[model samples]
Target: MLNGLTDAGSYLQGVSTLQNRTVILSLNGNYMAAGDSYYDGLAALGICYEDYQKGGAWIFENGVPTLYLSGKEYSQKYPIKDGEIYVKSELHNEDCEDTELILNGKNYSFVENGLNILIYDQDTKQVIDHAGTDIYVSFEMIREEKGE
Candidate 1:
């Protein structure tokens, strides 16, 4: 049985098969592949990869389609789950509608956009909230400028 983090290539292979995983790439828009420089630090853990995501999009990576950010602001909300909820999202640039963000949604849409991630376990109640690259964290954030 593969206990705690057997290796990096193994994890990537597993992620390729995961149904609910997200990469939020910024590649040339591969069928837009992508990557980030921060991941190189994983070498110390003995987990590494040959290629990495370097694009900007929240699309289905395993399939044959690409995704990109648009000029549309979005505002939606969801009640906290038992006063404890874990949400994860990846974003590179805020090309999402070049307009003034009105105060709305379960979160502050206009808040300073930065590298963010979160994960919580129901049983252990372990919370890992990260704003930047956390080797113990599994994520990659990318950005693409307009008129590139």
Candidate 2:
């Protein structure tokens, strides 16, 4: 049985089998996969990954991802799961049709921006109270044209 941690790398691991999930480790270097089971087992302990050198904690609670900044949980909204990641460049390359997002060769034509995305039913095409991220991208938010 492992006791309290004394170092960062003591609890972090780079495992190939986990794919996108952040692999954690027991104090004795046992690999722990990310999932609800681990969360349930460790939730009360606030099982956070602290970057002592950088000053922050990466948290995953109830399948919702968040960043603990300044001791507060700030949600990092992302809903894409279990699919091939399609970046903005690929969206451009595919010449994505207006109002249509093709993921895995299927059309998902509805989207609403929220902390997490809300993609609606395929047939109804109306925003449902759910979350999804078939298309994910990162870009700077600019208020005015550059070089103006």
Candidate 3:
């Protein structure tokens, strides 16, 4: 009887395949996959990758990715490249204000002077200013004028 019990235990342990071990490990937060059942639970709490593309912006609550533009979910995962421009909007006085911007994984700055707003390029450090008047300047335009 003792030998039979030992054999049963060994068999059960042998039946624990790598996939089963992985599933168990994932359940314990030791592993993670994109579409795993356990990952879905984490995603519900915003604990997934909130990646964006060259011209994309998103917000990550926990780890999930939420697009900043449309509030629609992304069907695929992406990474934000260097010098990527991301347009976002802000609401002031119950009115929506849209702005074109980019972040180089460094600093964040906003320039607003009277009716003019400026967006700075992280790479060239150039400024693009937009005035309520029909006058607007791209960062490249400013750099070209300055011979930078």
TM-score of each: 0.26, 0.18, 0.20
1 versus 3: better TM-score goes to: 1
Tell me the tens digit of each residue's lDDT in model 3 across 22-56: 01001111112222322233333333344211112
Q: Largest TM-score belongs to which candidate?
A: 1
Give per-residue CA lDDT, model 1, range 1-148, as digits (tens).
Answer: 1123234334333333433222222112111112343344322222234332322222222322233333122222222324422122333454322212111122211213222222222334333121222223333322122232
lDDT (C-alpha, whole model) for all candidates: 0.26, 0.24, 0.25
Badly placed stretches (over 4 Å) of model 2 are: 1-11, 14-54, 59-73, 82-148
Q: Encode model 2's per-residue lDDT on 1-148: one tens digit a residue.
A: 0113222222121111112232111110011221122232233334543432222223332233333332211222223344421211112222231222333344332322101111223333332222221212211111112232
- Of 1 and 3, the candidate ranking higher by lDDT: 1
TM-score of 1: 0.26
- lDDT for 10 in candidate 1 is 45
Winner by lDDT: 1
* Candidate number with the higher lDDT (2 or 3): 3
